[model samples]
Target: MAAPGPVHEALAALPLVDHHCHGAVTADLSAAQFASLLTEGAAWPGVSPFDSPAGVAVRRHCAPLLDLPRHAPPADYVARRAELGWQEVNRRFLTASGAGVFCVDTGYAPYPLTSPAELAAAAGATACEVVRLERIAESVAAGGVTAGGYATAFEAAAEAAVRRPGVVAVKSVAAYRTGFALDPERPAAPEVARAAGRWLARGGRLDDPVLLRHVLWTAVGLGLPLQLHTGFGDADLRLDHADPALLTDWLRRTAGTVPVLLLHCWPYHRQAAYLAAVFEQVYLDVGLALHHTGPARCRAVLEEALEITPFRKLLYSSDAYGVAEFHHLGALCFRQGLAGLLQDRVDADELSLGDALRIADWTGRDNARRLYGPPVSEPARDSGGPPTRKV
Candidate 1:
């Protein structure tokens, strides 16, 4: 049996909730790899994956946008899935989720979503279990295409995620493809801020504002939480849009607006935590830097999250993408990461283990429940296991 990864041991010690993530699909191994990963003497550490998976993990999307090129088409999405060899991604996660995972976040708006009902139906068919749909608006789409193209994608994806069962929230991945450099195609928020008018005055792609407004209206009706992807995104997005500070005004306007989850607190940690502390409708997700940075940086992020954000308002998730290890590692970071943070506790530390545990619990899937919660008619399982068990 292989030894478990450091992150896994940490997770076993610290309870956590995986609040944010996108569950894609995987398929390859003849059988699900759940046993080997979960077995006592398997080669690698932690539970093996269940073969046959789908969905693009978040890590693939994490690298700096400047270094990135284009987003993958649906077909390309599948081609890019990592080969786990014989790893089992799902069953083990299911085990954790069922034990106390909290919840799983299947990506939100399917940018350039094709069909509404069909997409919704398709997700329902998958074992991955779609929890929430992230909706892309013209703000998201406009950054990529003419306003019309953006709107079409947003409308279709929004409709699909809203209607699916087990779905409780709809998130808007509002990052753009174009940066300060402008292009006729692939525009994100930065482009929208400057080009919106001239582009509109000249009839530049039909006003993204109109389309974004439509998206906001449609989602507000759904009554699910809206997750705004913010900070340090790709090359195309304006640094301004990435800041949670900017979002506060947006949040203020929508004060009573449905709840919102702010993912990727990049450049804006303190500000993000302040917002989480101030509004019941707002929460923050910090998952990326957990592994890349040493435990200290991870601890800083966690401490800030607890400073103001109500324990309930705080959420957890791998914010992780890429392969199974990414997911496993991210989940572990949330658990152990908090414990490490607590290790430095002082009057300045300001947070308790109980508070950290609550936040950890939130990270798993609690945010999804706050947003897309399973239907009352559906049988509820903690589904994902608790973050701190010795699976």
Candidate 2:
């Protein structure tokens, strides 16, 4: 490990802007619910997900924050979590993360969770929403829009959502729905109308490829920073197809138009890194991968992500969802992994200590600030845990 020094201290002191993440659970989770949050898999009866790396990492890291010893047994840790209850747990973890702004993706698993306003209030940070393109389309479909009117209705809804207060960007789960093998050109109006008609007739999920293409094109038209899930995710993603490399053609088409933020690039992070290296508008983050990798292995993931990517093209995100523990663990692992990697280079004289510190600030906060602008205010925690804007 790099010796405790100025570089480590500097990385620790810089507040993060969790640029891509989800709202935390508002209700206290049962042990099963909590364990479910730790992994992407479904909870199996009588099986302990706690035996996994993420489970063990949670016990190792989060235990101490809850006043338990490191590596507390799963039962002990879960029991203690129950004792403190939801609000305290959220406060303990969110405050500890040192995130000044949470750019929350509020589309997935939206219910029984904190809203952006609620998250900012509890975390004592500013919060901004990223409009989910597919979710908006589904909502528009659910309202019984006729085939011919679907395009107009969807467009109006997306525009209204973007214009809403505190909404800063748009997101697409194309990786989950249709994969990145999308046509770079915008879909024709007739083709989009046909796709929309078929999609509304089905009245279910919005996974049609033509319709999905149309959604992506519409999002580009909105002209906000667009986030795409490029790499690792739940079982819904076909890992091979979700590769960022597949999007190069689309990236080339969208160049100089909108900023494309790639989220949770793992196994394909190196590929995402390559894209970020070559594309001026491309940005990447290894958020979901970091927590599961834990501090021990996350350094390698971070190293791979940084290898070919420009320093400014890398962004920090927790990709946190459900429990606030993910938000905490993501930040904790990122800091440890990044600080350790840069400090090692500094020790080997591969990079100047000054360069390491500046790079750390750029990845941790500055890049996101440049992309999203400033938060509402540098809010501070008030009594009872409501966030208060700085004077």
What RMSD, rounded to one decimal, does every model reach?
12.5, 5.2
Which regions of candidate 1 fall more than 4 Å away from where they truly are? 1-16, 24-157, 177-209, 294-296, 343-372, 375-391
Window of ten residues with lowest summed lDDT in model 1: 49-58
Question: lDDT of all predictions, in order shown?
Answer: 0.46, 0.85
Q: So what's the TM-score on candidate 1?
A: 0.57
Please write out the lDDT profile of model 1 over residues 102-170, one tens digit for every residue. Answer: 234554322222122322232232221323332234234444555334445555666665565544455
lDDT winner: 2
Candidate 2 residue-wise lDDT, 57-100, digit = tens: 89999999999999999888889999999889998999888898
Relative to the true structure, candidate 2 reaches a TM of: 0.94
Error (Å) of candidate 1 at residue 256 is: 2.1
Candidate 2 residue-wise lDDT at 19 = 92
TM-score of each: 0.57, 0.94
Count clashing residue pairs per candidate: 69, 0
